[model samples]
Target: MNLANTLAAFPLAVRKFNPRLLVHSPVMFTVFIGSLVCTLVSIQQLVQGSPVAVFSALVTVWLWLTVLFGNLSEAIAEGRGKAQADSLRAARTSVMARRRLAGPGGPGTFTEELVPGTELAVGDIVVCEAGDLIPSDGDVIEGLASVDESAITGESAPVIRESGGDRSSVTGGTMVLSDKIAVRITAASGKTFLDRMIALVEGSTRQRTPNEIALNVLLASLTIVFVVCVMALAPMANFANALPTPVVLVALLVCLIPTTIGALVPAIGIAGMDRLIQRNVLATSGRAVETAGDITTLLLDKTGTITYGNRRAVEFGPADGVAPFRLIAAARLSSLADETPEGRSIVDLALEQGDGQPAQAPEELSADVEVIEFSAVTRMSGLNLPPGYPANPGTRVLEVRKGAAAAVERYALERGGFVPQELEEKVLEISATGGTPLLVATFDGTRAQVLGVIHLADVVKPGMKERVAQLRAMGIRTVMITGDNKITAGAIAGEAGVDDFVAEATPEDKLAVIKREQEAGRLVAMTGDGTNDAPALAAADVGVAMNSGTSAAKEAANMVDLDSDPTKLIDVVGIGKQLLITRGSLTTFSVANDVAKYFAIVPALFAATFPGLGLLNIMGLHSPESAILSAVIFNAIIIVLLVPLALRGVKYRAVSAAKALSRNLLIYGLGGVIAPFIGIKLLDLVVALIPTIA
Candidate 1:
């Protein structure tokens, strides 16, 4: 096929669209039209026996070839991507299930093809197993098994399931693990959870941000400028009888209106995302890297992101008369049956303290006269003991341990005996230092004994303090948000060096806080790892989720850290700054190159009669062919040099706003001016070394 016809046919065949080709940049179309005009002028001159017409025809032909090649390259690349996606979709379909018989006498197998809303009968086995995708959404009728839910949830964890009733739902594409199960189809193939998840991912891919649209617009504008410049100058040159002027103008248009700019822009973004992958971070949106650097506030979840997220009992104090070991034994036994993280921590600490052996089971503990289960409102649990062997008989004391400092203290004051002011002061002091204080109280129906305190602390991550300092240095405010009580949250925030702390914050509260920060003109970055944290993560300017986090968190976050290290935030921010600088530098240099083309080609076109203007043209740079060759070579070299810059990011710090703007303008703007002279000199030297045809 001819070049124009091939370019037109390619996109339709591949199901791809190029907006640039559709709108038809007037400037570029003008350049093409100008070349056609020059060809006509050259033909007229040839008929009139003018030698200059031959050179003009050559230049016109060269420009057409260049434009043709550029368009063809773009069509091929786009076609390859579309073909690959189509192939993947086909492969996915092939692996999907088709109807099969479940044996004779079992619902009487029929040849009727099933569609959406097809009712499934009981005892009909859907026949799904490991790696064999389920054909439809269903509920388990019989058997028990585990299923891999990675495809739907983005969580690689396997979930165990047991057959019961209508509430048990199974998704298509999930892999069955271990035992096989009979599932009665609830929803047909197209309406399953898997279908919905697939739709969400596909929809996400289609949603482009404003920045991406702006970049595309800029590229389109440049293309138009290149085309217009060529069209305007080509006819004027024909009137001057300038030899090779039209050919050189055609070549200049091809070189200046680089079609690759549009193609390469997306390629650069993809490459940046690849770099993030190497660092064990997944960038959900291609533009996230750019957005991350602009963040002014960082909101971190207190549990996993700041503290170790695991609780461990660290300190113990007994009542004045009670022995320390006795209190420990009672606490250990009380925690034995508890599965909460705090209870486990207490039991584990007690075991370790008593020579690495767990406390005897709850059944083995001294008979409890009365037991108070943990209550969220009261924040305490207790076992009331009857006065026995050695102690006073009327002292029917309740041994209690609770989470919150204020609640425990208020309970102590209401049922007071010995105030234990010293103990209370010590516990409050520890709480302020970021330790979780558990109040151990003994109450005898009316009066309460203020027993000693038990402190459980979340382990601090190594280098956490230094990392927080680095964030502060970068002018990014760091805040801790958690569901933990005020004392525990404040304690961890202090130890982690966070600038602010919000305690007892729910998912909605976190979202509100983020919105508030944004309203104050801060770009907020939030890190979270819970289903509850999904809304806040989505609301933030940039959301970073741990790879080990809940599926909802990962799906909502802009970035995921595969290593689950919060410190990678620093590395990502650095990469974002580098990308911005690199893009800025490339754009400045590209525009400057176009400006230089105007200087080189315009003067040479008016050179024949305007002798003084011709004098302005450098020797050996008289023809459009030479200028076309120079511009193309220069463009290629600039793109090549940019490869290393993109790969190895620029080194930058979180500096004052003024300093940052000054540095960027100087490095990108001024640097663009200096680079071309050096590049041109190098190119001249290379050209001089090559042997020329006579």
Candidate 2:
């Protein structure tokens, strides 16, 4: 085993006597007294008789004590390291395996043994049975099933998967729900979609946060101080007879050093991470949590972040002087074959608005008509009526419900019909208030028939604006990225009070925007919930994926939010900042405590050298055993006190880096100085309260 690993595996009691532990000044002081006690006893025994046995017995006892304590401390550190490793491994295990079926002639039978370069023919059933892992990335050829993609996406719910030509694609590692699926492997084993996701999650482990590096440096520097203190004090105390034996001095030094360092720091970090988990936020990488506190920019997906993703139709308009019932019937008839939310809403409104019983089926109308499907890019739905409808001669009406006021206005202007000025004004007003207004019109060649406007609005999530304000208060710039046009994006951004907006952005465009922002040296935190956002989320400095988001997005993000609340970003940033501060405070106190131990030990070493100076006697006032006990107890107590602080999380306010640094210094430095005195004094009181020493 390596030195660090070996020390960690050692028993706690044995580790207490490790040379590294005793190297601290406080421990060395204790060892100096222990050696003095040993030598004085040995000399007395020699003067009396049986010098050989007496010397041998004393040496054996001293060596046994040293080894026992050293091994004890080593064991404690080792156990803690092992536990941390176990937690990390558990996190890795959460990545589910992807599996695919193979024929007898195929490269592998079982999914577990499948290699990267395996090939398969078309129509071959790649079965993904219940509880079976997905083996490769492929489109579902058959079967309807739900996949539990939480591990991959951070989403808590299971997603339904169905087979079709181009619409359904299954990733590796997703659990098959009800029925088995036959998939044609699109990507080979290691190159599958799940494999890439696993690679991404695994890659996060390599990136260490600034806090972790700082703690490591602090520990290394303290270790050096500890070793130097032991080396310088051992001989000086031995020559002056302050410590009668060198072995006692060495043992004390070993106990003191490791007690303060190896045992304390890791404990604080582990506890802090556990606390963060309890807050419903999983920080896949420690660095992510660290960076969250310092994030200066937050890029949000507009659809699901600030606004409820579902779109609902709220208003319908028909031409004046025309019966409202006729308009309703036409809209219902035209929308019957459509399944989009807007179409469904119109059909429902027609049914509700009609005076008598609603038409049981749209196909029964027998009206010769033309239907145009709504496309995301065009943002419109259209229907053309034939002369057969309404059973009246010379009646032709074209019904259109289109998104974006600008597109509809242009279409109307081209038709030589000016949209009423009041209608245009109303549309602008609604758009400004964050409502998506769709213009519904009915026209028959000659004089245009203006159907009343239909307004469909995406619901605003409560408290979203307040959360955006909080992020801003913390100095995080909020940018809204959406596929919606300029008007819709602007309206939402204004309502949400976002700092900036990027409209008409596709998934690829979003990625480009993120890259541009990154090039500007901004630490961007991207929040998203769809597969389209995977690249951008991955490219961000800190990717926060919602629990309800697509598996791809979740896989790409460094952190997952169970609540999926955009406002939770505020909480995350707060927790991250507090974690860094807590860790910094703990490390600072640990090192400062080592410095105090040196002060307590160094002055005493010289007290006996000059009787007039009274250095050696002053040093002898407290035995090495007492000093070692005091240091170990103090170190352990500090760790215990810090547990609650990490659990509670530090209260952080948004401030400049300078202010933050200054505040942290004051809290850590002042706390470090005062903690030991109070801790040691309490120990002394408790010791005094005891009946007697053995």
Candidate 3:
């Protein structure tokens, strides 16, 4: 632990000593009562000049430390988040917005006004330029620009925010680096995502997760059982002629209860959220983080999540008797002026074939050349070169095109050209291999002929197979949803190692898949970015939306990945399981610690009256007073020792739940039983040296 953090949290820990706040935790509150009772007994003994006064006062001080140490652990976890919230608050200061005035010519047509960002509301249009901070959370309505989101995400690299698509949403406090854009505000004034994140990290909006609540109930019940047992011990002690002092009885009761786990529960929960924040993920509720551990079915979107979303040209298959170079040349020429990802890939592949030589830039094309953009209706994109343009010196115009197999073949057939018989076979082979077949063709005035096929594929992301296997090992079934043919989806799924897949799925189908999985009693998690994904994102148990996704998707999801990584759900799941494991392990250690305490204090309390009980005192301490004081001191000191572990959380491994349980039990449970024996005996040796206890 940093010395600065400990010093800062001490005051906050002191503030948490109020009974109104302490009463919420039943076990800790019982300890608080025991501390007060011991304090009074110590005062009574001191006034009467009893030699036991010093021993009683030391026990009283340690009991109070036990409660304070618990508060300090929780305060340390909260302080980390409070510091982050303060930084976010600074960035959230009101800025000047270039609000576009609605004039007679309509919105964004004429003038602008400088208004406070806080004054802006939903549907208000604002213009942002280079070096200007984005005024508020909104969707870019017009233009495009490079935005620096360092203030919000802590990443210095600039990202592009443009009109339309998944990357349209812009956050306030992010600076516009280049170009200009008209943004239509989507969030209300004090209700931005930043405000929500600030509240979450500050611990104000945190609520106890179901697992935490259930564990609390169990701890309370155990505390009650121990309380009855301690009361019964008093009568038994009197009957045996070995009545213990009031302070000794209180010390024994405090040591026997499960104080270790009771004190660290809040710290464990808070630290879980802190881990997520450090990973650049913002979960709306602690419940979502907890639920991630229980997710049995992971419904992942095929595009951008499992695969790299876009299909790129990887190979060129020429028609029989046609040179490979001819096919590559035609593919490159048709895609030179094309701006689409597929088109750029084609040019790149062509260059790779030529030993990485640079090709003619798109801007180098003459004015006579025209670019034919691809559309749903045409299903093809190409270039039309007029005569005497570039390397062509013919009288007739040359038209080069590349697109879907059927679309390009139909174009050749209509233009008095024919598709080669072998080209059809080539297309099927590519399709069977899960690659898109784009036919490249050329026409000069009257005659047209098919050149070859371009093999484009949506490549599966690297390490997906290993990642899926890890999830499988943890008993999670991976399902992929895609809008492709069954053959394509199956090929990709096989390569990615997913357990199942939904082919040719639509938005409704995606939602139905999530609902069906949930109906079968499985927790489903999915990631999406488009407006069409909103319903499904909301329906899934753990919905993680990409930061680059549209506003609708971000609003509907329960968690947001600030870095826009689709696979971050894996880390979230790991963190959630770690939180549960940490809580369970500490609970085991706390209960096992009681085993050693019982041996140290129980025998000393009765061994004087019942000689046979002396065998239980294996530690062989000097006296009953020394044994009781040592157990009390150990109980208080252990809370402070485990504070760092509670705030940092237990390490999580991607394994089955049974395996994790066994591992934790072996380490924390068995170790817990042995640790306190050594600790208590060591403390006894030290306490015996003190004249009052001896």
- Winning candidate number (TM-score): 3
Better of 1 and 2 by TM-score: 2
Which is the leading candidate under lDDT? 3
Question: Can you write out model 3's per-residue Cα lDDT over 22-105, one digit (the tens) per residue?
Answer: 887888999999999999999999999998899999999999999999889888988988778988888897899999886788
Better model by lDDT, 2 or 3?
A: 3
At residue 306, give the lDDT of candidate 3.
Answer: 89
How would you encode candidate 2's per-residue C-alpha lDDT over 1-694 as one tens digit per residue?
2456435545554434545554432333343345455566556656777424333343435434443433343343334334434433333333333335454766755443332224433333466678766655566767867777665444667766666422356655566766777666666535554443343233322344566667556555655575687677766677786743444444346434534433444434443444445555556666787787677788887876778866776766544565666555655655665766667776787677662435434455455656666666666666666654562212665444444566666666667665666567767766666667766555566545444466678877888888888778778898888877688789889888899999988888878877887788888887776677789889988888765555566668887764566556667777777776666665555556655555344444444564443442222324333443444445555544553454355667666667877877677766666666666545545533433210
Which stretches of model 2 miss by more than 4 angstroms? 1-158, 161-210, 244-284, 317-371, 382-395, 398-401, 409-418, 443-448, 529-531, 545-571, 595-600, 603-624, 640-668, 685-694
Q: Which portions of model 3 show Cα errors greater than 4 Å?
A: 106-108, 238-245, 309-311, 321-326, 351-372, 375-379, 383-400, 406-419, 442-449
Worst 10 residues of 3 by lDDT: 388-397
Assess every candidate by TM-score: 0.70, 0.70, 0.92
Tens digits of lDDT, candidate 1, 1-694: 2355445535552332243552333333434555577678768878988655555555566444433333343343233234323332332232334343554656755333342233443333465555665555666666767876554444577775456521245655567876777666655445543443333222224333356567767777776776676677666677777633545665566556643344344434544554565576767665687787677888877666677777778877665776776557656644655656888778777667662444555565456445566776888765656665122222454454444556667877877755476777877777777777777666667776655677877777888888888788778899888777687677788888999989988778899999999999998988776667789888888888765455557668888775567657767876766566555555555555555555555565566667777655553462544444455455445544554443344566667768866776677556655565456545545544433300
lDDT comparison, 1 vs 3, better candidate: 3
Alpha-carbon local distance difference test for all models: 0.60, 0.58, 0.88
**Clash numbers, per candidate:** 6, 56, 0
* Greater-TM-score candidate between 2 and 3: 3
